[model samples]
Target chain A: MMKILVVDDEPDVRTLFEQRFRREIRSGALAFSFAYSGEEALGYLHEHHSEVVLILSDINMPGMSGLELLRRVRTEPAPPPPPRVMMITAYGDETSRTQALALGADDFLTKPVDFAALKEKLLALPSA
Target chain B: MSALYNFDLLVAGPLCMLIVLALRRFFNLAERLPRWNQALSWVWVPAVLGFGITAAFRYRSTLLDDAYMLWVYAVVVLTLLLLWNYRPARLALLALAPLLLHRLVRFGLDLGNLRLLAPYASLFKGWGNFANLWLIGLVLVARSQKRLLAKEQQQRQQEEQAHQLIATQNAELERLVAERSATLTQQAASLQQALEELQLTQNQLIQAEKMASLGELTAGIAHEIQNPLNFVNNFAEVSAELLEELAEEQAKPSPDTELELELLGDLTQNLQKITQHGQRAASIVRGMLEHSRASTGERSLTDLNALCDEYLRLAYHGLRAKDKAFNATLHTDLAPVLPLVEAVSQDLGRVLLNLLTNAFYAVRQRQQQGGEPGYAPTVQVRTRRVGDEVEVQVQDNGTGIAEAVRQKIFQPFFTTKPTGEGTGLGLSLAHDIIVQGHGGDLTVASQEGRGTTFTVRLPIYSPE
Candidate 1:
């Protein structure tokens, strides 16, 4: 089972991402979770570290940031570290991309989210 | 008859010399005189004495003596008249003093009335008379010579002055000629410079206008291609799935079916690729079109925040589509209460698109230089209400521009990209649309290696 965590400050964007992948969730091909802020996502990571396989985070959020989270996740001493993290942003700027990629983000996705392309990307992920 | 009055002659030099004297003080008629006049008799007095000698010469004959004295006195009177032209006539008649003296002395020499003295005056028949006559002649000659010398001196002075005047005028003429030549040369150079600048500006405006029209065409074509490409993508994906279903249903061993499945798979794969590439092409076209297109004459109260988001997404997607490994951290500090800018939606949209696209390219350039592979490039688009203006700032923490190029970045067709990639029209068109077309302000602030910030100041009510 693969778990995908979605984080964003905007509830609508988080909802949209969830709604797009909801069908796969019901069919049991993927399990999805959500966090409104970086802190919440980090808290979820603490509790459900093993269940999480892929993380999708937004760059601009109050209380910690997506880049900070990516940096932290990369530095964790655990073997194999955390799951693959992808940044989803409505604001896709060059600086954000480089910083996120450097902090060990596996991929970067910009909005308005191209769900069809995104679905293919999620499906191509290696099964753990 | 060469018969002339000696006093008349002698007085001519003195009288004329007085004119030079009054005009420019030829003699010490002024308060000062040089060595010749000093330690010498009054120059005029010696001439007066000499004139009296001619009267003495006439004393050789009684008839001549009387005539000489009478005529010499008259000549003296006329000379005095000319000299006294500026002074009083009463003073000039003082020459009659000599006449009175001659009369007194003549009567004293011989006891005679006016008629007897007239014929046998004291001018004849004795050495005493001759010596006196000789003395008088010497006096007349000396005075005449002095008068000629005074006249000569005055002529020399007039000639010197005329020469000085001519030299001054010649120098002035030369100076005027040189100055006029310099002025003409400067005017020609200025005219040439103005002409060159005008030509450059004309080329830029033409390029911008053409780019504007090209942008519209590219956008329309991209939109036009979009619908068909979307259909192809949708139908191809649907077909790929349908074929899988068929392959599952017919579990019989058929070589022809296997071949059929293989061919369809290839077709599906190719179509998928075509869709991907077509979408990318369309996006690029749209980006170019958005940048190049001018705003429709539609004015609306615009939300700068939303505009930034749209263009930021376009730029990011376009960049990402090119390099998949590029992942940048994005931040937006959009003021919720940012005053609405009365804007031409399309024009402002292009300006934002140009800035965002440049920001992405700048960062990509840094990455290409092998600075850092995964250092997430950061771009922040912020909006603020400053004074009466709504300022939209697009900031990117990428490779900052060098100081030298910062000034020329906004010039049309000035691009830092490799050949065939950049037209360098992005900032220039943005400047025209913002400052010229829209009556707004566009400014840039950058630090090398830190980042660059492009600020757009839009008035709350965009003026027509």
Candidate 2:
């Protein structure tokens, strides 16, 4: 099963993600780990870097931003072929999009995220 | 005249020469003498002495035997000696003293009647008389020379005084001119400084106004949009799960296909609309937040009429957030052909927001008071491009300010709203941004108990 980590400051995002991917989750095709902030996401990665196939994070958060999380994930000295990182932002801001791409983000999405497009992108990953 | 020329006359010439030399040395004549008079006495002194001396030797014996000869010699010698004792007028008196002595001596000689002395006495008397006339002429000439010298000295002094006066006046005039020029330059520099200071203050006021409007909008936006966002988010999540369940039901044995498909289509459409409207609300909240952030102060070309229209709706909605029951009709007369202008949009938007808030407040106040029949609370915003400038006006037909209060409206810390409800910095800050920051004009026109209108004129291009 593909394991994905979702990080956001809003607690409702956890519920939204679970609902959107309910079929895949029930079929044993995918699993999701949740973190409310960049710091919490990093703690999860430290213990489960091998299990996590991708990280989906929101850009504007209370503590570390999604861009900073992307940087840390890209530079992590983990096992071969680190997980992919996708940055999500609230306002479709061009400056943040460019910055995230430069910081080694795999893709960018804006809120409210299109789950259909996100699922297609996720299925294309090698781990899936 | 021949009889008068004798030994005594010859001696008189030498004696007169002595008197002239003595007068010249004692009176310092050469220094005082005018050019014409200097040479006047040079030739005449030698000629008089030469003629008298030659004739005196010829008649020497006759003149010496008479008693009057002694008198003639004595008078000439006495006049020379006395010349040192008196000034010009007194010297003339001394010349006459000798003539009086001669007359008294002649009277005695006639009374004696010595016939031998008679003929020689007439010759001596004539010589003495001629000497007296010569002495008198010298005194008159010397006195006239003194008068001419005195007049020349007076004229030189007058010229010196006139030159000194002119120099002093010239110095005074130059000093006055320099002082006036310096004052004008100083005043011009100070005026320039004052203008720059005024501009700086205006920019600050606009910045403060932005902060104030943002402070109010943040609370209202948070409360107003949070519920709608929850609805959108909650419904979308439920619909996504339901769609998954529908897919599971389809995979199961024979389903009521057309009815189920229709119900699913309706659910999908409803969720899509809810999600779309939620995102739109989020974007608006983001825009309101942008207004309060630090601006780059750089200008961009923006559509003025569109910006005004957007702000009008945002302000009305913001007020709705605070007062749930507050509602008013909003009217817009936006110009269709407004050219895009280079301006700092965030600052301009704040100015518009402040004016709109005040307008809404005015109408609300009138509504609360509940007087005036058939009064509808209304706010109108209009925009147009006039020449090189864009004009925006916000008007409210409720609770118009008194004439005296209108004058004080744009002053900082001035407000009609009650304490604890206002900072009184809104209108002043708006005034600063329009007038100082954008090189614009902000003005108000109102009649008490009728209505109020705030007009802002902003230049389209900001010169670097």
Candidate 3:
């Protein structure tokens, strides 16, 4: 199964992602793990470096931000075959998109996230 | 010659008394010439007595001549004494010198040749009459001189009185001018004080206008955030519906009990999140309503952390609502165990709003300048309890304020923003609200091209 890590400050994001990807999970095509902050997401990545193949992160959060988290995930020492990181923000501004792309974000999305389009993009990605 | 002598003896005593009385009455010499008055007093008494003696002893010519000569000698001696004592009348009294000389001559002739003098007795009598007429002329000259002296004395007194009046009037005029100038000075001071008060009132009015606009911006932000919150609610509801459908499928025969349990659990969690987000939206609406409401200037114990957090969100969203392209990383470090502070929450909220708005503006401006690459526009808000004070700090990693601008930042009507973009009373009003209204302190520290930090220190207890 393809493993994905979802990071957001809101605890409710876990439930939303679980419901949105319920069909794929039941079919044994995907598995999801959740972290509520950039720091927690980094910890998860360290523990399961090879298991997590994709990371979905919200850009705005207290403490460490998503952009910082992305920079660290890309630059910091880790196992070979790093996970693709996608950035999500409430403000869909060109500056944030450019900054995210410059910081090596694989994709950018605005909220209320287009889950259907997000699902199509995920399906199109080469499976692990 | 005898008849002429008799007429002279009868009239001379009375006429002398009459002349002295006229001088005293007409010239007011009794008051003007005191020594003359004293001498005249002695003369009038002797003349009257001499007249009495002459009238009583007219039959005895020898006795009559003795009385007349005694009186003449007394008059001459007193007149000479008056001329010595009273200098002003010396010239007038000198006219009587001839009378004294004539008396002495007659007396010498009587003593030398009484029978030989009988052949020229008429001539002698004529000379004696001329001497009497000269005495009369002397009296007229003395009267005229006395009148002139009296007029001169009156003119001198009048001039002196006029000078005194002028001096008094000048003193009164000077006093009036001094009094008027003092009043005018007092009025000018009061007017200056009034003008200062007017300027203060005008600054307060501009602050109120800024607050009103902030309230409107707050309402707009509430509406903007509300849209996304509504979407969240709708999406959560839809997810719950999908979960029900999954649960319905599991309810059929031979359903996977484990999957059914998980679907129900996710449905319950989704519904709970919907409720949580709805409450958050409700609180934001309430905060906006409170901001727009008229302030009652009431004080209460308020949670500083909550106030700061709410204003931070409002300011960020407000800016975002205006400029959708703006974005900044916000960091908050609120002390976990902070005490409630006694404060006017509405006024304090305005102060926080203003500070946050300024921080956001600074970051946005720096972002637009686009000089430094990899510059993440960042704003940090921190609250701490420092002994008796609660300190709030708003820091921005953006273009720092210049040293010159920082000095006058809190002054009213001092603006750095272009016209129509800022009212320039924001910092001034914030300073006033914190320092004057709540008896707190507001201070700033900045470095050009680096960053800026604004610190607000509020007392825990309200000042009485």
Per-prediction TM-score to the true structure, in the order listed? 0.43, 0.44, 0.58
Interface RMSD of each: 9.4, 14.4, 4.5
Model 1 TM-score relative to the real fold: 0.43
Ranking by lDDT: 3, 2, 1
lDDT tens digits by residue: candidate 2, A1-128: 99999998666576567666766887878899999888799999999858898899977553355777888888878886678888886453577788788889888777767788898988887768
Reference-based TM-score, model 2: 0.44
Candidate 3 segments exceeding 4 Å error: A1-11, A28-128, B1-206, B212-220, B239-243, B246-260, B292-295, B321-326, B364-370, B401-407, B461-464
- Which should have the higher lDDT, number 1 or number 2? 2
Per-residue lDDT of candidate 3, residues B1-464 (tens digit): 35423444455566666766765675466676687677766554554465466456653344445456557555545644645555435644566566666666677766664433565877777777877787778767777876787788799889888988888898899899999999999999999999999989886776576665575466446644654495466557567667677868777988877766766776676777777777777767766666656667788998989989888888887776677557787899999998889888888888898888889889889989997878878899999999899999999988999999999999987889998777778889889989998999999999988889999999898468
Top-TM-score candidate index: 3
Error of 1 at A53 (Å): 5.1
Scoring only chain A, what TM-score does candidate 1 earn? Answer: 0.89
Query: TM-score of each model's B chain?
Result: 0.46, 0.51, 0.61
lDDT at residue B225 of model 1 (Cα atoms): 49
- Candidate 1 at residue B164, lDDT? 78
Clashing residue pairs, backbone N/CA/C < 3 A, model 2:
B6-B56, B7-B56
| DockQ per model, Cα | 0.05, 0.05, 0.10
